[model samples]
Target: MLKSWTAMFAAGSVISLLVVVSSTSALRGQPQPGLAVASAGSIHLALGNPSGATEDPANKDNFLVSKPQYALSYNDANGIANWVSWRLNKNDLGIQGRCKDSRGRDFFAADDSLPTGFKQIKPDEYDFPVNGFDRGHMAPSADRTANRPDNCATFLMTNMVPQRPNLNRQVWESLESDSRQLVTRNGRELYIIAGPGTKRGTIADNRVMVPASTWKVVVVLDAPELGLAGVNRNTRVIAVNMPNTKTISGNWRSYLVNVDQIEALTGLDLL
Candidate 1:
């Protein structure tokens, strides 16, 4: 049988959908005989879909886009992702490096997969030095280096947000590196969700909204093969909420927060 739960935000507004599958067939990567898998073969959301996003064009703000590399809820009005979730394991790591364009510059391209009428953010829209924001990635490039195409998928503009230099390069990057350490060194599998919070303002001719803060939830598991069944009360969940400003701590641990706090802030039931 299939069961589900809902989490309401502190504001008494937003609600999060949590789907739980009980069948052994579902755990084995197959849908139960009568049910259909939403995004077949995509293990990125093995844990859950935080916001209940769908591919329905009418739900522009919470539109779901699933890919082999990762899955994200694209917000059309904000021109950013509501959240991006992916599963990380040692097998996903490799010697492959970041992708580049013909000129050998870092390739940040528009996601042609977005439905028509959705603005496809351009790489140059970030306006780097002038804007003082890095084209921050929700799914860090290093986390998807298993192959060329996988790594390149991370460069899609839809997976990016405007982030301050200090937070992006220092604390955020450090946390990303540590997440990989859990996989490469400690032999752990992780299901991570990350996104912007509380839009502070807009950029690129008011095309993309800048968030006041950024947050992430990392659920560490003992093994990738075990998947969601491995998670329990003892699971190690690392959630962090960091301010997006010029001044911030270099250590990611300094911004640690509880998953409930993140849910209150982002209104997503991250598991």
Candidate 2:
């Protein structure tokens, strides 16, 4: 049977100030290596030029270049590989690091939120509410236990937000499932990084190259043989966002956002 692939995850990112959202990078971490990592700031979270992020071509939209961040073992519960101190770099953050086992099973605890070196951010202090925000994922659920509990720390209130239930469960989730399956089925692996982006100006749902809350799940497949497209030796990018379910109607349609032709608008040399 020519089976199809599937990937699943919610669409949204919200939580308290103490939260550690994983909406930007791939799911590659080294918490087992005992390295201290912290949540990204607004500039760090910017997708276009704020943070100077790269891109992923496999998934729906070209997103970012996520990387693995690790640390030595911390506590015995996390079963960390080491506890020695280390440092995580830029390649270790944002929509480039949202993949499966290719990354670590656990995410980092806050530098201030009680020594998060391979330490799981237990939800004891913070409450994870269903109506509050979307279950912002760190290490991709596929990388953890089926229920995303192997590294329960990654599922903290700091890494979540309010997301649309339908889109989260429908198109977006399908993308996640398909990505992971592409790895197992093809004997390869896929890396992904997802999250939110805000445009420079605000106009009440102003449309930009990247939309807010679109739950931009930037996926990066390692092997080129997974029948993948939208990428190249350098980088191919996709920038899809969550649908505005609040106003989405069947009678709606989207087309090119310009009056001039492609050459006129971009002013590029096509001839």
Candidate 3:
């Protein structure tokens, strides 16, 4: 079943049809023809297909998978995602009195449904309490609290990468916090895509890949308020590329970059 589904994804039939459904249902205004859209389980989010990158590895090998909160392009060989995409909105956060996954598990776990020959990454692969690396979240847990299931889904190991402790706990965490604030302050929805810029290296007993840096691309829009028509040259886009090392300062905003810069580094076209 999974193989066949991935085959369809490679043929572009599954996600193409899904894009049409997402564009029609999620947007209040007309979406430009042939824009890239990603599905977060049932929710469809828009990506304006920013130009500059020659290609996106996520669309390769049919490993793109969608959960209720985010979509990731898994690289089974490297045991990490090339990118994870998700939709962020006003209602996506702030679950009063609920602060964590109700399952009582704070650890990252394997995704069993992944295709054969791909070993499920373990929670301890991040070298916690030893090498000082953290299992950093790409699609942050804070942004997926629309429901408990949504929040828990973000804990999948595939959505994580090995990050330095200081970078993860300080700067990276700040960026995740800012994403939610951006939505609340603007009164709109945001589309986010994030991933690692990896070098030829491995960490944690060679089980996990080490990212040279981490990057994210965000497209801000007043969706359902201004709709797809709101996306234009003037649309506010925030792109950040931060070092994966411990030397990163407390301010994540210091790494602010343009979408083109991120595209050039990751070979991904993100708007």
Instruction: List, residue by residue over 1-271, the lDDT tens digit for candidate 3.
Output: 0011111111111111112222323442222343234332224334522221112334333365656677666776678887887878887877732234357557467776566667688877776787777888998878877776777777789888888888888988887877788787867687788888857478767777888899886666756476544544344556778898878886776787765567678776553
Off by over 4 Å in 2: 1-133, 136-139, 146-150, 199-212, 217-219, 222-239, 244-271
Q: Residue 181 in candidate 1 has what lDDT?
A: 95
How much lDDT does each candidate structure score?
0.81, 0.28, 0.64
> Candidate 1 — which pairs collide?
none
What TM-score would candidate 1 get against the native?
A: 0.87
**Strongest candidate by lDDT:** 1
- Candidate 2 residue lDDT tens string, 102-137: 366434333223232323333332222523223334
Number of clashes in every candidate structure? Answer: 0, 51, 0
Output the worst ten-in-a-row residue range by lDDT, candidate 1: 6-15
Candidate 3 Cα misplacement greater than 4 A, ranges: 1-45, 48-62, 96-105
Candidate 3 lDDT trough over 10 residues, lowest sum:
1-10
Question: Between prediction 1 and prediction 3, which has the larger lDDT?
Answer: 1
